[model samples]
Target chain A: MFAEVLTIGDELLTGHTVDSNSAFIASKLTEQGYWVRRITTVGDDVEEIKAVVGEILARKPEVLVISGGLGPTHDDVTMLAVAEALGRKLVLCEKCLERIKAFYEKLYSEGYIDDPSLNEGRKKMAYLPEGAEPLENTGGAAPGAFIEHKGVKIFVLPGMPREMKAMLEKEVLPRLGRRKFLQRKFLAEITDESKLAPILREALERFNVRIHSSPKGFGKYIGLIIFAEDEGELEKTVEYLESRGIRLEEA
Target chain B: MFAEVLTIGDELLTGHTVDSNSAFIASKLTEQGYWVRRITTVGDDVEEIKAVVGEILARKPEVLVISGGLGPTHDDVTMLAVAEALGRKLVLCEKCLERIKAFYEKLYSEGYIDDPSLNEGRKKMAYLPEGAEPLENTGGAAPGAFIEHKGVKIFVLPGMPREMKAMLEKEVLPRLGRRKFLQRKFLAEITDESKLAPILREALERFNVRIHSSPKGFGKYIGLIIFAEDEGELEKTVEYLESRGIRLEEA
Candidate 1:
């Protein structure tokens, strides 16, 4: 399966927050045998979010994971954007409202909140685009959401790392079981990668494995991250490279 | 000016590499007064790279910063993709060849390489898309390239953090120059942000400063990142929030 991740936040766009959400989703999706084709990030602008949703949807990834902007803030506009993009009406999810109320009630009990009342902004978290199912946010107030648009599974998760992680494990993971990736890493101590290029190119054409090389300064070492699902073929490639005087550190 | 960043590498998409390159470029662009519109990342696929290049170019961001995939390996396909997208030919530049030769010669003198001869793979780095200028790499072998397309300045830098940073500072920054961004961060300890909602909406409406609020799990605190180019507007917004029982920490 192919997947795409759209992360929304000005914090992420401005570098106030490094987008660990996309990486986390990508890694998780990769483990489930879903090739995360592209990861797109935009600021907390409804129009940009809506436009990206349209674009990524056109690309037609089987699964789409969107993180951030599901907060009580004015900047949180993912729901509105998704609604507009999917031509769905923004409606209140009663279950989500109950969850938000319970969250505030717990805060009230713990003396974290002055009142258990759900104010307008807090209540807004309960609103989801039409036909959206509220995914429980065990770690926070705003409930995460999931919707199916044109056969694409769209998951809207919170921006908070803690909350996003918990919900992803509970809600998204089971939907995508698991597919292990077998990658063989190698660090070749080479004086010049140019010397090994012929071997690298030949190996790439000859084997099922895909080879990637990162040049270390002074041509002393080239870090190679090689990917091959077939263990036997990978071993043969390793042996072949080693036989050609490429000192490979099978990491 | 509008800006966008594209960081290319399979390592990045597959989660083996965390894309710090986009964030670094985004931050730099933000500081230079460019509204970094969006950041898109793609794996080391030629078609993917070409498609994104076409899309982002059509978006017409005045400045587009591209990092990664400029390596001596077979996976290094960004150059080829860019050339094809722009209808440019891949041609070897003599100047780039001289630099490559010098780099290898220095390595040979230092006894880092067994041979100083520039193989076909090493020479391949000199073959840039037509009309592309080599941005001298102070740290590595592959020279970074720069091209101007339809008034958009496209900077292609190496993926290695060290090389990308060096070239960005030396080659790309001067072209962009600098633009200052004025921002104010505040921590508002509040029982309910919903209570402050009216004030925040009012503040957002009345002031030129763009207000962004981040909900801290409980209704205990809300982190705010506000942006204002006008000094007076920033002060007015700050004062108005303080007057409304919003305990503000000028972070």
Candidate 2:
């Protein structure tokens, strides 16, 4: 299945934070056989977030993974933007309210907080898009979300790396089907890629392999490396190129 | 002025490579007073690249910095996608060809390459979008590009971090103007953000300062931070909050 990742935060856009989140999520999705088509990062502006959300949702990829903007702070607006894009209302989820209350009460008992009463900032965390199921968060205060809006399966994740990983593994992956991809890397001792241009083109048309050649320096020749569907297909590709006199040494 | 970054690569989309190029560019742009609005990554597929380019260009940010997919490999279609997005044709530029020739000849003289003749793979680097001015590459064969298309100043940089940084510093920065942002972080001993919500909201409305509150765990409180346009404004913010009985320790 094709997928897309949308991460929201001004820190990422301004270079205050590195987006290790997208890479981590995309890799996990790739391991599950999903082709992540895009990873987009936008700031915390409501209009910008809503515009990007609407644009991405319209494309309608099978899997849509969203991270960040799911907190009690002023800038945390991903949930609100998603709800606006889906034309849904922001309503307080009862389960989430209970969870937030319990979390705070437990903290109060442990001398973590001065009081157990819910404040506007903390209470706001419980307000999710209507009909959205709260994805449990064992490591953080804001609960994640899993909602299928307009037939698009979305996994709303927190920006904190620890919480995002936990929610995706324990809550999201178990519900999705899996896929696989076969890939191989090769290096050759040839000086010119033009010498094997025709062979590389032929391999692409013949075996349907997605060809990617990394030519280092001026005269180095290519050993057309490919990502095929299976080991048999990759072997067939190697044989086809070798038959064309393009001997490749695996790197 | 506002800006955006578009990074092109299949390796990045599939999580085979972590994209640090956008952050580098974004941080540099931020230092120059440009507010980077977004950073988007797409695969090597020409259609995908073209589509994203079109979408980004339509928004028409003041500055657009693109990195990656500028090499001679089969997957390097970023230049072609950009040309199509601007409704331009791919044409060979004499300067780039000369640079490529000189680059290869140097490699040949240094015993790096078997021959100095331009191969099809190497020749492809010269065929940029028509009328594009080639940026000097001190670290590689592929030259970057700086073109003003549809009123947006676009810099098409190489995927290699070394070459991208050199071109941006030497060729791009000197011609552009710079802006500045003033920021301050604070640590507080308060447990509830609701205690300071009214004052923080007032600072946002009274001044243009963007306030962000970070709340950690149950008993701990928010560390209110402010991003102002000048040091004086930041100082005013610190005084304003402290005067309201909201004690903040500068971090």
TM-score of chain B of each: 0.90, 0.87
RMSD of each: 2.5, 2.9
Best by lDDT: 1
Number of the predicted model whose TM-score against the real structure is largest? 1
lDDT of 1 by residue, B182-244 (tens): 677889988666777778888988888878787665657888877777778888989998988
Chain B TM-score for candidate 1: 0.90
Q: Look at candidate 2 and give me any clashing residue pairs.
A: A112-B219, A190-A221, A191-A219, B32-B179
- Root mean square deviation (Cα) for candidate 2: 2.9
Where is model 1 more than 4 Å wrong at Cα?
Answer: A177-182, A216-221, A228-249, B177-181, B216-221
Residue-wise C-alpha lDDT for candidate 2, range B112-188, written one tens digit per residue:
87788988878989988887888889998888888898889988989888889998889878766767676666886
Per-prediction TM-score, please? 0.92, 0.91
DockQ of predicted candidate 2? 0.55
Candidate 1 has a TM-score of: 0.92
Per-prediction interface RMSD? 2.2, 3.1
- List the DockQ of the predictions in order: 0.62, 0.55
Best by DockQ: 1
Model 2, B73: alpha-carbon shift in Å? 0.9
DockQ, candidate 1, comes to: 0.62
